[model samples]
Target: MRSTNFCLSTEGADVILATSSDEKYPPENIIDGQSETFWTTTGMFPQEFVICFHKCVIISKLTIQCYLVQTLRIEKSMSKDPVDFEHCIEKDLEYKEGELQTEEFSFPEFQATHLRFIILSAFDTFVSVHRVIAEGIAQDI
Candidate 1:
C-alpha cells in the first residue's frame, strides 16, 4: 500500500518540556486542535518547545501557526528520546498586523521522532503559537 499524509497530533503526538507554560495558555495548546487556543511566552526571548511523535514519522511538510514572531528555527531528532537534534531550518517570518502568521516548510525527506521549535525573537514583547501541524507517514514500528 502507498503511504499517505496525516496529522501526527491526531495519532498520539505530544509536546515536550523546555517550553513556556501557562495554565490558561499551556504549551499543549499548540497541538490541541483548537485554533482559538495558543501557547504564549511567559518570559524573555528565545523560547522553544519540542514535539515528540508516537513513533518514527517521515514528514514531508510541516506547518506552524503563530503571530508576532520574527525569527524561528526547527530541529529534528530520530532517536528514541528527544535529544541529539540536528539543524533543520531557520527562517524569519513577516509581520502582519491583526493577522496570524502561518509558516510552512516542505522537506525533501525528514524522518524524526521529535521536533523542536525555537523562537529566536519576536516583533512584540510576547508571542503566541496557535498550532503546530506535521503532515507525513508514520512508520510501522
Candidate 2:
C-alpha cells in the first residue's frame, strides 16, 4: 500500500500549501500571462484513507456561481525506480456573479501520496466553502 496527497484551491485567489507561496493553477494548455510554476504539495500521505479540507488557504467570505471541472491524476511508477506519484493540479471550481454551486467528484483508486485541487473560475476574490472531504478505500482487482 502507498500514500496520497491532497491539494485544493479557489479561483482568482492565490493559495499556499504546507508552507509555500500563494500560487494559482493555470488553465489546461492555455497560458495567457499567468505564472507557469503553480504551487503544489509533496507526498503528504502514505496509505488508503480520507483527507478533509474545509479551509481554502485564502480566508475570505465571498461566494460565486459557475461550472466546475476537477481533474485527479496518478504519476507513472516503475519498479526499478523509486515510486513517486505526481498528481497534477486542476482547475475545478467555477463561478459566475454571486451564486454558489456544488461540483461533486470521485477519483479512481490509485496509490498516491499527494493530492492537488485547482480552482478554474469564480466571480469574486474569495472562495466560499462549507466542508470538504476525501475518502479512500482498497481497490477490488
What are the lDDT figures for the candidates, one per model?
0.85, 0.28
lDDT of 2 by residue, 24-93 (tens): 5222201111222222222222111111223222111212122222222212221222234354323345
Off by over 4 Å in 2: 1-99, 138-141
Candidate 1's displacement at residue 135, Å, is 0.5
Kindly report which residue stretches of model 1 are placed more than 4 angstroms away from their true locations once superposed. Answer: 1-9
Per-residue alpha-carbon lDDT of model 1 for 37-129, expressed as tens digits?
898998798999998885898888888899999999999999999889999999999998999999999989789989999999999989999
Candidate with the greatest lDDT versus the true structure? 1
Tally clashes: model 1: 0
